[model samples]
Target: MDALTRRSFICGGAALAAMATMPAVAATGVKTLKNGKTTVDLVANKVLAQVGGVLELTIKKYGKVAVVRTSKGVKGFSVINLACPHAFVTVKRSGNGWVCSPPGHGSEFLLNGKLKVPPATTDLKAIKFTANSKLLTID
Candidate 1:
């Protein structure tokens, strides 16, 4: 085996550090109704009460999705498909946004699903939803 170079070691460490910052919060309080709508209980997923919080889940109709808190009001949440528009690979939370990692072409999107980098010609797909004080219903 070849000896490890200092440059390679530093690069490897940097890559690991970047990956470590990605959020991996699981979906909480998810309930599928008989009528086919899905509901998330804000009380059970308290992280979503704060701005910038994200609750990731999968919907039967939409596949992977994220519910992001953009502001403090009841209407401040954004529901977006997590699949990268470029390659349809699920994006991972990175810093203040999302990144289309391996198997994708490195498309980037803001927390609200706005396109920030390309390879993707559009923003992440938005899903319709309604929110009240306690629950957010995905329609």
Candidate 2:
């Protein structure tokens, strides 16, 4: 057998390590909600605080959704479907927005779920929600 190059060995090790961690990471921090309209009281939940606050919810009807309060004292918020429209890959937060989980796919989206990079042609789906007096009703 041929000798293994250092680069190949390192790359293989890294890939294995990432694969080992994926399942746990994928299973954690995802909340499952029944299919239907859902109400979230920010104050009562205490999960979403202020501007830049991001709350991840897994709606049975919509898969994964990220609720972000984007503005302070302005009641500006956005709900973005975290599932990649192209391949349904779970998107995760990266800097001011979100990116496809693998990162190598180069799919990125803005805070409003607009497509910002390639490999994904369509924008992420937006979930409708109303925020009033810290109460958010999502449909």
Q: Each model's C-alpha lDDT?
A: 0.87, 0.69
TM-score of each: 0.85, 0.68
Per-residue CA lDDT of model 1 for 1-139, tens digit only, reads 5465565465445445786976677777899999899999998998899999998998999999999999999999999999998889898777788887665566779999999988799999999999999999999
* Collision count of model 1: 0
By TM-score, the best candidate is 1
lDDT, candidate 2, residue 9? 64
Cα lDDT tens digits, model 2, 1-139, are 4465565465445545554554322223333246567776677644466676677777778878887777755367788889898757787666667766542354778867899977799998988877786677788
lDDT of 1 at 133: 95
Clashing pairs in 1: none
Candidate 2, number of clashes: 0
* Stretches of model 1 off by over 4 angstroms after superposition: 1-16
